[model samples]
Target: MARVAVVTGASSGIGAATAARLAKDGYHVVLAARRVDRLDALAERIGGRAARVDVTDPSSVREFAQGIESCDVLVNSAGGALGADPVATGEPSDWAAMFSVNVLGTLHVVQSLLPQLAAGGGGTVVNITSTAAFVNYEGGAGYSAAKHAQHALTETLRLELCGKPVRVIEIAPGMVRTDEFSLNRFRGDAERAAAVYADVDRPLSAEDVAECVALAVGLPQHVNVDQLVVRPLAQAAQHKVFRGPLFER
Candidate 1:
């Protein structure tokens, strides 16, 4: 039997791309996401299976894990930025939502699947964090805080699972121009989303992030990549985005 790989947030963007790449790599990919319709479509295309999973819900994650008899890899990509309000003006609810999905949700999925990963003989766990994990920007308080928490979790898991058969990894991407990430962060404001990547000649795409995930996970089991930070040449830092006609390079 082929190895089993579970990918959260597999309906679109990085998750979908990673699932497709892993499928091509010969693993029987299992695409899990909240959008059943999209998941089914993607699963059909990749010759994988789809599961309707809401990573934020512990019961849902537990059930999903139980359904899979064997799992060699897990890609925790089921997270998003909720709002861009500054710390002082940020909605507490938005902050809570981000934490629930980005931090706590990752923990829940790891807890549920760690045993399967171990059983499969030194598997890998790839946590999809972001540049916000280690940086701060105005109007990015909520998302940054949540990603920071996730970074902490990823590090702690690596240390705690030291002797175990699991290798914990983190992939942090900067200036990724996905269809939903900025749009959802701006509360569906199309103009605001478009302006986020307006002047950048090239921004990281979902496939770019997926390539990172595939590289990290496809490494020999003895090789563990602790973390990787990916950004477009146009992005030097979280706040250093060059814009406008004169700034374009």
Candidate 2:
């Protein structure tokens, strides 16, 4: 039987890309997300299954878990940034929303699927974090804090799962240019979202980050990658980015 890999946030962006890549790698992928239409489309293309799951809601996660008979790999990718306002002026709602999805959402899914992950005797948990998880930057306090919490969660899970049949991996990417990430962060402001990647020479794409997930999961079960931080060459750090053409167009 093929290994079953469950990818949350599989409706679009990194999640969607990872699902497709994992399918190509011969895993029976389960595409989970709140967007049923998008999930269905991707699921059909990849010959996988589509599941409606709101990772932010514990009840939804529990319900989703009930349907899966076995899960060899679980990719917690159902997360995003809401806004980029400064801390002092940032809306509390936005902060709460970020935490709910980035931190708690991951927690809910992991907790619910842990049994199935461990049952297979060689399971893997891949958390899709971001550079914001490790560093602080202006206009990114809320998202950063949430990611930091998630990073901590992934670390602790690795420790707690020691000797268990599961491997916890963290794949953090920087400057990934995804379709809805920036646009959602700016609340549908297309101009602001487009400007985020303007002039940057090939910011990381969804497939770039997805490849990281596939790599970590494809490794030997006994070999665990504690954390993998990926960033485009143009972005040296959270606050440093080269906004010029560095490659041939």
Candidate 3:
């Protein structure tokens, strides 16, 4: 029997890639996201199950978890950035949306599925965070604040899961080339979305993040990678930039 793995935010980017990757790694991947069509397409390609789940709603998350008999791996990639303006000028509603999905929504999934995990040997959890956790982004206060909460959750969960079979890991990637990211950041401004990746010499792809996740989950059951920070080569540091002559140097 194939071990089951649950992936949130599975409609696009890292979550989508990780779901497919896990399926290739022999786990029956259960993908949950708001975009049912996209999930259905991906699940079809991977021969998995795609279910509509709104993480922001506790009951929705519960129904998704309830359907799972037993789960071995959980990839929490359901977060995204919202609003990129100084807090003084940023939309408070966007900030609230970020928190609702990134922090509270994560807790909803964790709480609903934890008992299943505990009963099934305490499965591993990989929460997708951001490099923004350790640094600040101007006009990105809301996204950062929500991710900070996730960072805390990762660390706290790790400690709490100690000695148990479960492991909680965090993958903080910088500048991943996922349209879902830029679209969310710019609130569906496609022009702004295109500009974000255009300036960079190279940006991390969704598959790159998924590769790291696959590697982490591939490890021996006794081994645990607490946190993995991945960034594009051009992104030396949070605010630091390396120049390339071809594009917008």
lDDT of 2 at 27: 97
Where does model 3 exceed 4 Å of error? Answer: 245-249
Cα error, candidate 3, residue 9 (Å): 0.5
Per residue, candidate 1 scores C-alpha lDDT tens digits across 96-157 of 99999999899999999998999866789999999999999889988999999999999999
- Candidate 2 Cα misplacement greater than 4 A, ranges: none
- Over 88-177, each residue of candidate 2 has an lDDT whose tens digit, in order, gives 899999999999999999999999999999998789999999999989999999999999999999999999989898999999999999
Among residues 3 or more apart in sequence or in different chains, the pairs in candidate 1 whose N, CA or C atoms overlap within 3 Å are 122-165
Better of 1 and 2 by TM-score: 2
Every candidate's lDDT: 0.92, 0.95, 0.89
Q: TM-score for model 1?
A: 0.96
lDDT (10s digit) by residue, model 3, range 128-201: 99998878878778888899999998899889878788888899998888867889788789998887777678
* TM-score of candidate 2 to 2 decimals: 0.98
Q: RMSD of each candidate?
A: 1.8, 0.8, 2.2
Task: In angstroms, give how far residue 93 of model 2 lies from its true place.
Answer: 0.6
Segments in model 1 whose C-alpha atoms lie over 4 Å from true places:
244-249
Instruction: Give the TM-score of each candidate.
Output: 0.96, 0.98, 0.95
**TM-score ranking, high to low:** 2, 1, 3
